[model samples]
Target: MKLRILITLSIMVLAFGIVSADFSLKWFYPEASNSTSSSDTFSIVNYDRMLYGATAGIYNLPDVNSVGSDPDDYLEIVLGSDELKNVEDTTDSSQGVWRCLDAEGNLEWAVGTGTDESRSSVAILDFYGSDGLPDIVSGTTSGWNVEAMDRFGNFLWTFPSPPHISGPYAWHSSPAVADIVPDISGLELAIGCNAGYDSTDNHWGMYCLQADPSDGMDDGITYSGWSDYPTAPGGTDGTDWDTIWFHPTDAPVISAPCLVDMNNDGILNVVFGTGWQGGIGGSLGQPGGKIICLNGEDGSLLWEYSTGGSYPAVSASLAAGDIDGDDDNEAVVGAYDGNMYFIDGDEDGDGTISGSEIAIYYHSGRVYSSPAIADVDGDGDYEVISGIGGGHLKCFHYEPSAATVTLEWYVDLGDSIISSAAIAGDPDDATPWLFFRGNVERTAFYSHTGDVLQIFISAMRGDNAYLYQVRGDGTVMDSVRIGEASYASPVVADIDGDCLLDLVITGANASYDSLFMIDFPGPDTIWCFGTDISIHGCETTEFHPQISNVYTEGCSLVYATVCVFDDDSNYVRGLDISNFGFLEDGTPIVPPNLEMINECPPETAKVDVVLLFDFSTSMDDEVGLMYTHVPEFISALRDVNYRIGIMVFNGCPTEIDGICNMVKTHF
Candidate 1:
């Protein structure tokens, strides 16, 4: 009888211990010299059973040992082993990529492809390939690069892209990937690019690429070709290229592109960021931001909206997801002016609504980083996760049925969070985590309960580092530190065959710039591929210029012509004067001879008029008005020649339609 009782007690105790160990949270802070603040943060993800992260520079040393003029340190999670390896060189700019590893840190892998020292910036990755093999794609300073390798890091085929310039001015934004075809076609890829330099000429846009598994090459080449989409209109030679359209707006530069399946269609469509004008700066001679939407397939303009008033001089980042559980996606955009916007509605995805509706707006004076979209409340709907320039993190919730968005929670970090937030763990889980970086200081984590989980700070005087990580809750995790400074986000992956998650970060230190990987041990194998979902369509609104009409006395009646240009001064179709007419206070005017404008007498017209047309598809009504008015005026003219002229305006173009000269002729 005594033995039986003892055995039963032992079994009960063992079961209790297992439950606690499996679900409890633990924090591990590696001992470091007191002088070194363990803040320069990184990220971690759990796959088969592993933890991973990257440490900037070496212990006690502030510099990394990488190759090329831009050297940096990178840590990666080894897949099949319990190990964290740091790859450093003096000549390569390889710093950003997603990493993963096994529980013992024995195996690891990273997604991103680039030259040893030139191209090394990884954006986002996932398990999207058809062969079930993990693939990786990265955006370099020059162009987009991709590669498929197994857990052993064996080279498969390398994807190719258009050759880009390689210098201070030559660079590409991060690449975003997704599985658009599900079980068959592998994954598609999207990359952001800045066509030129300088604010006026900067051409910001996105490129879509489909992955092909059959191409086998190792010479930094890609089998997937690129689509010849029209360049975004606005600015000059393509300079301040930041992101693509994810919402709706009037300006091309202000749009941000994201991938999602808003209508539950098997094909994932691209969502554009709307609101705001002129990225880093406000519009030409004006201040404030505007949002514009575009069709992902043909880069056609959709709808446009604005945030009202001149912005405080900052760029904007976008986030999207189903926020209200209404089976529709909502958009959240962050601006440097310390404001965040929430746009709701169907956004023309063939759902409950066709146009976007404003759900809410929040103002946080601090410059805002990119936003993270997730179901932070675990209510089956997503909340807006954003960081402010003042180092504050906030979450906003939306109730579609009520048409309202309310603030859920907020936390201040005492520093700016320039990077977007990354979410880990299942949404339905009891506990989930959110991760983000504090500018130049630390990487912090928060639980679903709005409690601080852990804070990782970096040592000063060494490298300005960017940190990235994955949330495994209590399972497994990983993180990595790439360089001394970073303007890009970090990526996560399971590198080795260990089934754990790893981290990849890209940035530049005082010595050089490079992409680094950090491997951590976890519990499950993580697979990732390089692909992107396409954007289905867009919605646009008529553009109304704040300063639309300018009246000048004694200007010119001679020959006047009207022309239309896009945001970048690129001429738009159907802007010809032959298709438009003018009305003076509801009075119809005759169509003037546009071909003879320069030779016509300046006094006869006396009034110089220019029309600023919104080229987005949403402006169809406005464009149609011009056509209707023009023909009516032509009929009213009666005389063949009239002293009048017209001009079209967009970004910088003074005239798109030819100059016109009109002379009154009577029988």
Candidate 2:
């Protein structure tokens, strides 16, 4: 449901490029372009045919999207009669709810509440595994609780169970789920705390709780020994509820901690940062922000790095990848001081980063941008893309040998930049760029098929706010104005599941409080998802759901299939011959197969043995990664033989099957 290594190509304005709403009016809910105000922007995920937006205030996400301001934050929104517990905010005059919308600007469901307010991020996974459905996991600004709820807006469980365990510690950090404790039964949920909006002295930390408590403890809290760091009694009535561990921090961790298994070990390491509340100790207020790595098993510190500056706070998040093909990930991040640091993620086998283990590159302006690793020059190696203060967007080529960075190019947009850059593939490029193509085991899509697309989001102060999509030469490919100002950068994803990607974003000023999606207008390429089932006989009389392929194993028994989708485009299952009536040649043959195929194709197209396509882990995965690359894979198959055959998923190459922690292949 999340990307470990964000793969991108090309270069651009601020972060990543997208097709703006100006070119095409795909959609904006409430129907009006300026119906609501999306105050501060947060993050969002379009999965299961829906979009779950978190805390979007327009800062990477939190721009001025209008999240509530309360000790117990609450937000209210209206979406197609499906009220997700809307709770109004006294501080906010606008009403824009965290929503789950389709590509056509149609809202499936919308939820807003007190415990649900100010959710800066969300994690989509089968938290409890109950009903075998993916649930939504998010943390509220002051909720201080890792919340798990179904897509229908049903409240499932809250870690530490009711009654204010730590007195509303504020969970600005999005909950991360992983099987950290193998012996603990279910999965583990790791989350961090923010400044708590506390005026003066207040401590911030992180939590490691059970991903699903139904399997073991019913209280939704358990941390083996709760050892390593420190554990405070969270049970209000003394019922004895405890968590895995609590790693304390002097300042707020407004940034979401990343959970990565850097070494591919079964265990994961939590990497995160913190910001100074005004400075803790020392005369000039020591740089409060720092990068901290925690041992996922017991909540211990793996390694830590401090950023040097007047008030160097890492408001932006950190990214990890193997820059030199060393198989070890290097941590990349930026600070408010306009500098980006590169840390050797214990690559030297010393388990600690020191002296030569770290490298620094300055953007020369305050940086509020998170780094995106991609290869823009197609030079084979990856480059770092980020935005800094003074309205500059910079790219640096990463040299893993010396752990140093050299500026490849820099552009001053004449405005401040707090937005992070995003990477994607332009529909026109031959190979959609992927991050670390050398690490074949990690990528989800087929490399060398689409070119990399880089886009930048500027932090403009006034109506000068604009979305820029640039070519590799720092020239504008396409530029459009999106309202007055948008602090948060929008994302380019397939909102309608059209098999094509779309751009979804929120605006500022008059266009705040609204979440809109615009189609990425370009080549309407079709990616062959296995969803296009084949039907024998190719007849027109019988019911046919999108027929993608038609062939016979032996030309005997007829086989048919269909890709059934509800209004949301989610796959529809559980129906057999009874779901639809079957008829053949006017006499109502009542074929049980339900799918009609053309009379045994006069001839068959030859298919050559191409490599198996792996639909493994990718940035977007409501369906398989192969969904986007299927077109190329099918084209390759057809070019060789003329028709496609049963695909052999060798895992691109392999998406890495966790069943054996190895690559998997099947007919």
Candidate 3:
């Protein structure tokens, strides 16, 4: 047997347009000459602007200080520059640290540290000193060396690791600051360092320190000077440090620490990255990358997740945000393999949480940069943003209710974006604007639709930093650039209480890192707001009838209907099959039962019919018996006589001329 199948296909159309509303942009002062960075300033007012970035040649490092006084009268930035001397014709490209300045852009004092070995990383915190002066806390290198400095750049104290806890490598991640006071009394600071090793012969581990601001010891402060936080379980085993991998050619050790609040419980959390050093046989180790989470108060292990495979991609930096709208903060980590993971946190510390998954593009090139999250779309749901080795900015939005993630957009900056993204604006906006550095030489602004509105070029290395006034449609109303060669992210604040926002960026140059403050006039008055309404077409009815098979017996007929509706569930329109014909043994059966025949109702409505026939010979004896008996045969058709006709044939092929005329005359 052969069978034929019929298939039908339909397509739908959708329309979109800009909504109704107006937005505006305004610019204030511009801060100039910091180090290279992707950072921006936050705001308590309506006025904000971008500062100058550091030059590529100079090693001036600038750090954006914490908010002080009112949101407007806060710290702008501070930086210090140092020159690098060439050794054996090989110039040393190392990292440096600088001071943070106030909004006035005055020299608040500067300090520089690190030897020829070069500093791997630095973290700074703002605090009030016992002497009633503003003090700063900083950490660097792998030696567990943490220091506190007075506002005058004088080193007040330094904390060292215990004598029994000796390791070959130093700390890579920066220190995190927190106010442990119940309401706001005492300020406690925490710092984490990498303590583990790579080879089986030597194990590596992690260490954290809690320091007291009152004690001032500069030179050789021992662990007794500060409180010692316990390490993770099994972290002290000699095998712990042995997992470190080294590059084949460079043999660089890999580990870095990130500070965050993973549980949204108003407490700080610590996350550390561990993996084989890239550039060597880094792929040979099992569980090549691991992340351990610890409570900031006592350094107790909250949870730990390991990447179980050959050469799991690992990132040196990590950021935290609520990606799934579950109120629980999630950690965004990058990998050397260019993979990004969104590890959900268990707020209750119940040990049950979502595992890590590749949420961003994994480049074949290394991804040492960290990931940033913000609600780029003012929908209250945060979007994950990260830069790759080849300079690609990727964004993702996770809708937890649907267990689905949507790729919002991406852009290629043409250079490595080692830094993260900064998103800011009113939470009520449908689409808030975002700001980030493309490279050290240029800073660019983009709309939510991935449209590039403006590009500011600060130096040959590219604008290291940027600030913007974003409109509703994702367009940048205004933007400013700082110096070049930036690797830090921009921060937003209200430095001057004009009800607007201000920008702060950090970067380094050849020598000293300088912080600049640019103040915008007032709030941008021109606002662009959009509103949209969905519309649908309504369904109705239309008709078309055709006649077929006209003979002495009767005439056969058929009818068809068509329906059409719009996307907005409105204006529905269709057709009804009100007419039709039937066949008996390949013979046309006509309309004596025309009024008795069933009619097709509207497609949207349910339709039913019953057919009745009289097989009595007495009825067949009459010439028009079939037509007359049809009405009597079916009780439902007693009222209207739509059109009556008849037909009769007995085992003979007889062609009767004028069949319609004969039926009309008889009936």
Candidate 4:
């Protein structure tokens, strides 16, 4: 059988501009008043069915509502529990419009409806309620309360009973909950409250309470002074909460803790920072600011990182992601020292950030906001987005190898941004745009390559909030008035169920206290084609010298089939061996004839070639010549496929009729 095979090769080149796409603003809603600051990042949760946010403005306040207050800073929830339907018409320019308002002509679930700066960020838990939907939990910074509620705005329970502290600027920590304990069926929400008492000892660190959904407050959940701790630091006997992890710093832990599987070993750990000092220069030697990592199972020290300055504190919260795609989590944190750090969650399986695993980047001003990580460039690597007090939004390409990170680009937003920036658009679609608030001036958007795709410049000489559509080439297409004074980072979602993603954002100043939605009517899908190659062997041209077997010594030798066509035969006549064109090292190799080279050999040969000579006649002369040439002839046939045989006869032959008979045979 003839061996059949052919090899085809192809190299595919990827086209550029596959990632750059146009992202335009559809529409935006505005706030009703100018007294509130919606500073919290909206958490798009409940499987994207609900959007939750809070507002906090005043740097320091004695209580949630004091002498002067903006009552519009409340937790707002917009729900789309029912499936949204769209218009079937395809040819129409406006295919469908979003139903933002509910059947009752009101937005869904506006709980905590008052003007107290609720700074604690909202976290949506997968833990569901009796309604079979997930719930939202958050703590109030000024209110000094921790609470959980269902999706429909029903209050589950509130910590500290009254949800208010008597001291000035007594801030509560953001709630970090997880199913930590072994036997607990529900989650345990942990917080660090800065209720500074006169005596430092009275401040008994981090507090974790049972926020059980089933029991709510019925499960002996209440707050008291060291009553939660029987051993008591102040010589006062008190009951300690179920799990009370003491903060290392003498001061109260104001910074919220983040629970994550830092080591990726199926176990969780708690990471947080503490310090009241706004920046490194002021916080020096405060003893309140330090980044601490602890075990989640039982509060134990995993590792602790400090700036090593007199007061190098990490007052901002920490963000975690596997920026290197190595399945290892790294802690992304901004510090009062004006430096951003990337700490490897675990190195050498020791559950600690080694000296080599830590990488740092510095900004012109201190970073109060956390770093946001995403593959903004569609390069499969995450870029760190951080807003600094210097009014600059910086992006850094995270390269964990070689112990270095490089800055990609930074934009001067022209305002001291304390809020973390938000990133939207899919990297698979090759379109990632960053949205951030730059004080009272403007809300800007940009492509991953540091290009200004769109800019919503706050109008001149007026309290104007304009939303502008940006072209892919960094040009403003159109603008519209949306709201006023926004500090909260924008959140992206398909709220109207129109298939295109919409923007959900709120403002810091209370002109619009409620959450706003900008309907996105732009392209949401990307098209691409994969590359493939194929090949087939030559059909008409038949190669006679087919390779049968290959043998190799120092050099390789290939054996092939040798064919010789006979005249007037079925095979084509006048087959030329020179037309065979075999090449070795770019030199033509000519085939040898069959007899010259052992191209064709018979299976059997030399049965017998007998010679009988008459010794009585002139046999002497013939015998002499035969003896000389016979040895040489035998030596020549030694390498070939032939052997020699000889016989001698002395007597004459006696004829017997038609058959000739030998006279005598001698051996």
- lDDT of candidates 1 onward, in order: 0.34, 0.45, 0.37, 0.40
- lDDT of each residue in 305-349, candidate 3, tens digit only: 554334553535566655665666666666665666556665446
TM-score ranking, best first: 2, 4, 3, 1
- Lowest lDDT block of 10, candidate 2: 521-530
- Every model's TM-score: 0.45, 0.59, 0.47, 0.52
lDDT of 2: 0.45
Top-TM-score structure, candidate number: 2
lDDT of 3 at 144: 38
Q: lDDT at 338 for candidate 2?
A: 70
lDDT of candidate 4 at residue 306, scale 0 to 100: 69
- TM-score: model 2 vs. ground truth: 0.59
User: Residue-pair clashes per candidate, as listed?
Assistant: 200, 67, 139, 25
Per-residue accuracy of model 1 over 385-455 as CA lDDT, tens digit each: 66665665667676655667777776543355545554533312211211122111111122243211211
Off by over 4 Å in 4: 1-105, 113-116, 126-131, 162-172, 196-205, 213-248, 252-254, 277-287, 308-311, 346-352, 427-486, 510-667
Candidates ranked by lDDT: 2, 4, 3, 1
Stretches off by above 4 angstroms in model 3 are: 1-76, 79-97, 100-106, 114-133, 142-144, 161-169, 179-186, 194-205, 213-268, 276-288, 308-313, 346-364, 400-403, 426-485, 494-667
**Top lDDT: which candidate number?**
2
Q: Give the TM-score of candidate 1.
A: 0.45
